[model samples]
Target: MQKTRPILAWETLLDIARTDAPAPLRERVEHALRRAIDDGHLVPGSALPPSRTLAENLGVSRWVITEAYGQLVAEGVLDARAGSVTRVAAPTLSERMPPPHPPSDHPAPTATPVDARFDLRPGLPDLRATPRARWGSAVKAALSSIADRDLAAAHPGGYAPARQAVSDYLGRSRHVATTADRVVITHGASDGMSILARELRRQGHRAILVEDPSWPRLRDIAQTHGLRTIPIPVDDDGIDVEALAAASVRTGARVALLTPAHQFPVGAALSPARREQVIAWAHAVDGLIIEDDYDAEFRYDRRPIAALQRLAPDRVALIGSLSKSVSPALGLGWMVLPHGLNPEHSPAMPSLIDQAALAHFLVRGDLERHLRAARSRFRRRRAALLDALRAELPDASISGIAAGMHLLLELPAGADAAELARRGRDHGLALTPLRRYEDVSRRPEALVLGYGNLDDTLVSAATAALATLLRARSETPVASVRSERTLTG
Candidate 1:
């Protein structure tokens, strides 16, 4: 009797080939085959189907299969004799090493549940709404128009055209008074912050002031670059300029980072008097202010506030990115440095192609058009969430709804925002407690509800679920409520 060969499933390879991935046919086939082997779906000595057979199954030409198999054989992932069936290669020394395991006392980690029906986490836009066709066209146009020398190397600041485009857009839209010479393109706001932090440290700055409940990533970046962070309190009028000035004097810090247009997590724009005070403080201390102009494009109630940089361009280093107005996946941002500061030796810059594409996108006015549409969509979503929250939790304090993508929801006293958030996750709702953004110990009594990425259909349901959690907490015994530090919202 003849020995029977094991049959491997071809459906996985077929599915991969049929997907819309941009890789070439041969590369895709090689990737699929390599994955199968690494996953142990095709064990050592397992026979692979003939090239002709797999080609027919995957609806690709035989050459693609042959090329992929030859490459795998060269990589030692497979073995093939002159006329014999190709088989998965035996495990090499590195591959034979035992898989890493957690400590005996610790349990193995499991993947986080991501099937949440509603995701209200802040700092994300509707990724599904990305204008793929327009971006592709922009990229194509950029590729065709860019000179050969421009591709050879990128300027440390940025391509001239990209810088000019960004400068023009900021001047017109955000009222940032800057020229292309002052613009330095960065990977994103985080990258810009990192660069600024390093520069501040180099300028003999030992400490920097930040908003108490501001975005934590920027503070972390400053700390990483050897600057001690001094937390300054923020109120309805935005960062307490008095506290900032006192801290700067006490710490001898000459740099302060702020989110003035729309404060993070709390959504307070800097009051006009406070803005002037901040600029005066910068001048009095001869300090620099790093303005984080994030998510200021989608203001709903009225026209967007002019950028704080406009007031004192000489003292403020304005950083803005496409993360909110567009998708963060693009990894594009810009910094308008004060006259004396230069980012020639700053950290990594964005890709040349991406910068060119953005220039084209801006020149064609696609960015403004996109922002207009995004504002309309976000307005509707924000209104829906506000209406739902108002109707369900009338006693709860809601603020920061005047602008930005997220609003602060302060749960009534005795209700645990953290506990409510945990319960929310179990019911397919995502919640972020306000304490997550604070460096100091604070009560977890507030949640930041981000409606930018939430779907229209799920707004009502998400709010209802949150209300149920809050109601349940309220019904619990007073003895169950634990004392915690005070939180600012």
Candidate 2:
């Protein structure tokens, strides 16, 4: 059966109306009506009053009523039948926001062990070799000492002691300038980025500049704040600062997001000259820089490079996490903000209850012990990868291997790294394409191989698998004949 109700003409007209109602009353009613409609408080086909009579009922003028109602008709929210008789229009389904994509139900599952398969998933620390036994002891110790009220609810920022520890650690390791007061505990780097993005938006800066071939999760976090995202290109030295300056000037980019320590997946450390140029450019442009120090603790070659934050703390926001050092299970992350750009919530940024109860257990005691073990394990895995890669594919060169758990193998010219990645999976191996990081149309040939979770035996197998790929590509006369080159030694 069809149903009908009264008109919204008068109601909507009052909204956009140049009403004679007091300005305050006009705004209050307008907001209330809009919110009611949005929240489903005012359903479709709801009634409105007669113009002259309702104006009198509300102690208002007919002119006010006419103007308000006229607006509703103009907006198509009301349908006029005869003179002065109007009805509410049927609601449109498009008025509501679309539902979100479903959450990935699980981690992209890794297949069971296959002979000689090298696993190169990015950003994973070798947990199997982490000193789990020691971590267990720390967990037990932390649990035994915890007070009853500690578990009820935490300080919205984070545990104070953990903040103190992180402050101390960052000072020593990342070259960040801060005290415990400057530290805010967070779920991880992702959480801190979200909070910073929102706070930046509040400060009247909305867009973020990210590396085209950078971490994907950052795109999601920046977008959450209704901020626009811009992609900056990267070359051997790091983000093309000149190009970034051009983008900023052209687009009025207010902030630049950087993973300058060692770029994600690509593993190229930002050169000293480029780092200084970036800092200077940001200052000259009055732009804020976000420095993500993802894997600074595990560089196997040379004394560690100084973090970009240390060079310019006033303009730089530093983010680091325990997932790559201690355990992802903890989900613990921290940040160092320039004294005054401080976050109101410690690490609570965009998430409520970001981690499970067990996270605190990893923080209070096991952290120091786990970091020591993780550093050692990644060092071995990094070295083993380089050694095996050289022996197996002596001709298949690698980059970004001087530091971090992953390295990039620039494929022979004209080969599609993205397709090769899929091919690796087909052969019961897991690998990633360098193209995933590229933001623009690129035809480069490279693959990012992570060795964090792979064992020495599997490392050998994976290297052999990759070597076969290189050999087969070389055999094809149509494939562009280019020498296998190591971009990062």
Write model 1 residue lDDT over 287-345, tens digit each, in one string.
Answer: 89999997989787788889989999899999999998889989999999999887444
Q: Model 1 residue 114 lDDT?
A: 50
Task: Give lDDT: candidate 1, residue 383.
Answer: 83
TM-score of each: 0.79, 0.69
Candidate 2 regions exceeding 4 Å error are 1-117, 147-154, 344-369, 441-443, 470-489
lDDT of predicted model 1: 0.83
Question: How much lDDT does each candidate structure score?
Answer: 0.83, 0.69
